[model samples]
Target: MRTGFRSVTAVVPIALAALAYAIVVPVTPARATPLPSRSAPQQRHVREVGDTAITTMDGVYTLAQATRGGNVFAAYCKSCHTPTFHSGPPFRAKWYGRSLVDLFVYVRREMPKNAPGSMSDADYTLAIAYLLRINGMPTGAKPLAADTAELRRIRLDSVPAASSPEGPAR
Candidate 1:
């Protein structure tokens, strides 16, 4: 029932906080060292999030951070991108397997229906990996990267033609 904090109790917390800060704040020799900058070109160090892993030709990533990304997607994207509909076709009558790499690139480039490129690499990879999994691709030991070089290698399987459809393409 005491909505207002008594001055005595408030003073104790403030004093304790000040005492803790006083103890933690060092007033001795400043231990500051300048780290040497890399002379060579900067390389993007792949940071693994948590459990989401992607297998790419260049290397592998165990995206431990993808779990967060999955939740982010579900909260923002599940309404528009229904898992059942994200298949080999247009959820109705269209072939989506024409270009596997394009789809991957598009998703990586823009997705989540809210934030594009704002997501961490781990999130991006996990979203794509989950999409691929839904489309029938098997998950490998390693996680995928945002690299386009590896994605172009594997062809995506769209809706197979009802019959022959002129046998491959001309």
Candidate 2:
């Protein structure tokens, strides 16, 4: 059986239609909707501070970690941040939003101006703990964790920097 040019030309429109259909379908990711704020306090047991929430009221930040952290922080942080707050808030101000530890996790995952996740986990933890201490958070027996869970529980009054001109693991 020999197929002529006219027969092949007749099927071209059908193939073109199928290809067009495949290209036009729309696909998108599901996005979560923001909930409206409640007037009255619903959960009395939990401590809520605006956006930053804390379940662990365990007052456990160590001096050793803070000292080390101050070093890592000065080396990595300081340019966008200052040892004390300037424009909007002060370093000693009460924590209304995110914790110092939360900032540390964010910095560790993404920091050092150009580079992120460059600091050792222990150093990052220490840096945040140290900042917390400087912010008036009392030190405790246990050391701070490098994980987000612990970091989110504590808030920062202001960002910290290297104690002096020098930096890292001080």
Candidate 3:
């Protein structure tokens, strides 16, 4: 008998037995662990600014941050996204009412598809700053902090209306 033929015959029975065992045996789903209790303080998405809420409408990030974000996007994110993907009405519609923290968490956890969360928190935050700039949000005197707690303060509402040369219309 040929060596290959003998090996095939020997393996077939073992494969068939394994298959039969799988079919015959009942598999139970793993028990789910209970979620942690909310003993931690709740995070607030809105930051009060006098009578108004501080949102993306106000300057939350800086031009320098946005510029660095552009480079980051070109290096890592451009393969999957066009500049247009981050701009205009569609992006705003999807992201509106979500806090910057939501964006930061999402990108940090699931971006770069092949290797998620590879970038530092600062890079992800800068990428968000770029998105904000392209969408026509104003820049602040301060750069947007990379910290999640700071990011949570800014709610991403609608893209603000275009302001006149002097300032936003009342």
Instruction: Tell me the whole-model lDDT of each prediction, alpha carbons only.
Output: 0.42, 0.49, 0.66
- TM-score to native of every candidate shown: 0.44, 0.48, 0.64
Quick one: how many clashes does candidate 3 have?
0
What is the C-alpha RMSD, rounded to one decimal, of candidate 2? 19.4
- What are the RMSDs of all candidates, in order? 17.7, 19.4, 17.5
lDDT of 2 by residue, 55-113 (tens): 22234466666666666556556666675551223443434355655566565777644
Clash number for each model: 12, 9, 0
Number of the top TM-score candidate: 3
Candidate with better lDDT, 1 vs 2? 2
* Comparing 2 and 3 on lDDT, the stronger one: 3
Worst 10 residues of 1 by lDDT: 52-61
**RMSD of candidate 3 to the true fold?**
17.5
Best by lDDT: 3
lDDT of 1 by residue, 1-170 (tens): 35344645655654454356335532222122222233232123212223311122112223332343345456445867776565444521332323335665676567644444444444455565555544434334444545555444334433243322223211
Can you write out model 3's per-residue Cα lDDT over 24-96, one digit (the tens) per residue? 5333322223222232222242445334356776667778878877777876688888877667666777788
Off by over 4 Å in 1: 1-72, 91-99, 158-170
